[model samples]
Target: MLEARNLYSYYGKSVVLQDLNFDLEPGSMLAVLGRNGVGKTTLLRTIMGLTDRTKGDLFFSGEPLGDRRTDERAMMGIGYVPQGREVVPRFTVAENLKMGTFARKDGKRAIPDKVFDLFPILKEFSERRGGDLSGGQQQQLAIGRALAMNPKMLLLDEPTEGIQPNIVQEIEEVIQTLNVEHGLTIVLVEQNIDFARRACDRFLVMDKGQVVVSGRGEDLNDEIANKHLTF
Candidate 1:
């Protein structure tokens, strides 16, 4: 289990997350929902230790991840796909996926064939420059790179943002397969309730740096989801 208790975060003294608490079970998906600028990304950053946690404790598999560096956390099975799909623009698709191998501790040098099975387009575009791919393809590459780590837990931010409908559906299916088929835990920060509704087994709704509502999957309060998440 991954637990965040009374968590808090800030950007140059402007508090972004406040006393946020949540838990994700193994092989399950938790969706973090809110409108833009509600500190959803900050929460993911804090979990990955990319942002400082001013208060509270982060426990992964019952071990506290206090003051751990970002790379250290990745080594400990925390994988992240930041909002911008930060693929190395100059690197080929294959090269970008290789970057995730560094997160593995067992000295496994080979990229698993399963990764290629998950995102077959990457194999086809193995030699293509990351920057040359369309936005949706780049997003697939980003997720594929994160998968290369073979992480037990995955964090994604706004993966469907600016993506085409078909690509969005593909991402959603990937999220489901990761949880059900592979037993991978996922914490997703998404703006589209439709996608979240289909992919996540539970959700946490944040506003003004606080989780104001949470519940089982699409079981979230529709009125609140509409009021806070919809523009």
Candidate 2:
């Protein structure tokens, strides 16, 4: 559903991603794994047009996304949940979710019922301020907010970071459901190798701003992890 060719990304004068290339098929999940400072986050940001500058080709569902503004890309059906879960702190849960629908091409503003099904807590805490929620709750809210956009593809940066183990499992299950049951294309930057192996159809190990090793999920074994991922 998405393709990047010879992708290079920059933040100001410094290049952060170099010659990155990958393809994501419809209804498939790709796990991008690397140690810190290896440009994993930049890959997602570049895809969303959030980087300072980008070079090379980016195509979504066969159409080239050349010089498209961030909002335009959202209208094209890409939802991004950045590393910190950047939910609007002061907004009520419902309001925050509603904000996502602004990017919908159909101009519909209502939150999708599937979002509530994936995250029942969001419905329960609809009236609560986002800033008052616990970390795990906020992460769920972030994902639900992205889902509100009715996206075809989801770019998640470290969705399980800093969460409790139980909530981590919950998020993992949700990711799996989104890919398997709902047929959403997913590009996940994840640190948890176990969850990546369990949830992803394919895995890419990046180092020094490039994809070093990538293959089907079953091929991401101990040797590759020890060589490219071990800290």
Candidate 3:
């Protein structure tokens, strides 16, 4: 449902992504893995129009997304949960989720029943300020905010970064259900190897700003996973 061909991007004067190519099938999960500073997050930023692409093409749902603004991309069904979980610190959980639907073509806000079901913690803490939540709860709130957009393709950057292990497992379970049951297309960038392998269907590894190895998740052998991911 999403494809990047020969993508190249830069931050100020230094190039961070070069000739990167990958694809995500509709309703399938694709994981981008590597140790830090390998362009994993850069790839997602370029795709989302958050970073400028010097060369190459981006296509979503078979339509070219060349030179679109970030908000335009979000309106087109590309929802992103950035690496830091970038939630509004002062906003309540419900208020934060509401912001995601601002670009909906439909006039009314479309809150999916499944989103609340997937992250029941959101309902329990609906009125709590985002900054007051635990790190794991903040992460869930971030993902929940993205889901409120009803995106056709979701781009998640390090969903398990600093959460406790058990909470990471809970997040993983929700990711699996979103893909398997809800048929949400996902392109996940994760540092946690075990969590990525368990939830995604394919893996794309990056090094020095380019994709170095890629294969089915089931075939993500120990050598590559450990070599490319071990810190």
Candidate 4:
């Protein structure tokens, strides 16, 4: 559903990604793996047009995203959940999810029942302030906000990072359900190798801002992890 050809992304003058080429087919979940500062998050940012500049071409569903703004891209059906889970702190849970529906081209403001179904806690905490929630709850809110747009492709940066251990498993299951059951294409940047392999159909390993190793999920073995991913 998305293709990158010889992609290079920049933040101000520093070129963070170089000559990257990858394709994510429809309904497939692809994991982007790497150690810290290898441009994994930058890849997702570039896709969302959040980088300072990007060279080469990015095609979403056969259309080139040439100089498209971030909001425009969202309208074209790409949802982003950044590493920080930037939910509005002042907004109530219902208000935060409602903010997501503004991206809908149909002008519908109603939060989808699927979103509430996927995240029952969001419904329970509908009246609570976002800032009052725990870390894991905030992460779920972030994902819910993205889902409120009802995107065709979801870009998640480190979805399982920094949350409680008990809630991490629940988040993992949700990501999988979105891809496997709900048929949402996903590009996930994650540190957990075992979960990546189990949940994703394919994997790409990055080093120094470029893809160094890539294969089907079964191909991501111990040797590849030790060679490129060990910190």
Candidate 5:
């Protein structure tokens, strides 16, 4: 559902992503793996039009995305859960989720039952402030907020990062369900190789802002990890 060719993304004068290339098919999961500062996060940001500028071509569902603004892309059905889980700290759980619906083309303000179903804790704490939640709960809230938009695709940046073990597993299962059962296309920027290998059908490794290795999930073996993914 997403394609990039010779993509270069920049923050002012410094180019953060250089000549990146990838294709994400509909109803499939693609893993983006790389060590710290290799431009994995920037790839997602570029797709969302958060960067200062981008060069080359980016397409979503056969339409050119370079000219589309950030909110326009959201209306086009791309959901982004950035690395920091940037929920409004003052907003209640319900309010935070409602914010996502602002991007919906349908103009519906109702939070999806599917979102509450995936993360039951969100429903339980609907009135709690976002800042009052634990790290795992906040991550859940982040994902739930994105789902509230009823997006066609999800871009997740380290959804498991800093989360406790139990919630990590829960979050992983939710990601699996979203892709396998719900058929939401995913572009995941993840640090966990094992989970990525199991959950993704396609995988790519990047270094220095460019794709260094890419293939089917089975090709993401230890050799490739040691060579391109090790810290």
Candidate 6:
């Protein structure tokens, strides 16, 4: 569903992603694993056109995404939940979710029922201010907000970061459901190796801004983790 070739990304004048390449098939999940500052987040930002400059080819569902604005890419069905779960702090839960629908090509604004099903807490806390929720609740709101756009591909950056263990499991199950049951293409930037192995169909290990090791999920064993991922 998505492809990149020799993808180089930059923030200002400094290049952050170096000659990366990968392909993701429809209904498949890809785990992007790396230590801090190895360009994992930049990969997702480049895909969303959030970076200042980029070189090389990016295609979504067969069409080249050349110089498309960030909003244009969103209209093309790419949902991004960046690190830190950047939900609108002052907005009510319902309002924050509604913001995601602004990118819908069909111009429909209603939040999808599937979003509520995936995160029932969002429905229960619909009237609460986003800033008032706990960390786990905010994380669910962030994912639900992304789902509101009805994206074909979802780019999640550390969706389980900074949450309690139980909520992390909840988020993991949601990610699995999104890929296995709902068939949403996902590129997950994750730190938890166990969850990555359990949820992803394929894996890519990034180092020094490049994809160094990539293979089927079962191939991401202890050796690869110790060599590329251990801190």
Candidate 4 lDDT by residue in tens digits, 56-148 = 999999999969998999999899999989989999999999998988888899999999898999999999999999999999999999999
Question: RMSD, model 3, all Cα superposed?
Answer: 1.3
Query: Given candidate 2, what's the lDDT at residue 60?
Result: 95
Task: For residues 10-77, write the lDDT of model 5, one tens digit per residue.
Answer: 99999999898889999999999999999999999999999999999999999999989999999999
For candidate 2, the lDDT comes to 0.94
lDDT of each: 0.88, 0.94, 0.87, 0.94, 0.94, 0.94
Error of 4 at 195 (Å): 0.4
The Cα error of candidate 5 at residue 94, in Å, is: 0.2
Off by over 4 Å in 1: none
List clash counts for every candidate, in order.
0, 0, 0, 0, 0, 0
**Candidate 3 per-residue lDDT over residues 1-231, each given as its tens digit:** 998898789888789999978888899999999888898888889888777546788799888887788898899998899998998999999899898777565745867788789899999999999999999999999998888888888899988888988998899898888899999999999877777777779999999998889999888888997787777
Give the lowest summed-lDDT range of ten residues in model 5. 222-231
Q: Give the per-residue Cα lDDT of candidate 6 at 180.
A: 97
Against the correct fold, how does model 5 do in TM-score?
0.99
For every model shown, what is its TM-score relative to the native structure?
A: 0.96, 0.98, 0.96, 0.98, 0.99, 0.99
58-144 in candidate 1: lDDT tens per residue? 899998887788889899988899999999999999899899888998868678888889888999999999999999999999999
State, as a TM-score between 0 and 1, how close model 6 is to the true structure. 0.99
Residue-wise C-alpha lDDT for candidate 6, range 1-231, written one tens digit per residue:
999999899998999999988999999999999999999998999999999999999999999886999999999999999999999999999999999999899999999999999999999999999999999999999999999999999999999999988998899999999999999999999999988988899999999899999999988899999999998
Residue pairs with backbone atoms closer than 3 Å in model 6 (clashes): none
Residue-level lDDT of model 2, residues 22-122, one tens digit each, is: 89999999999999999999999888999999989999999888699999999999999999999899999999999999989999999999999999999
* Candidate that beats the other on lDDT, 1 or 4, i.e. the better one: 4
What is residue 159's positional error in candidate 2, in angstroms? 0.6
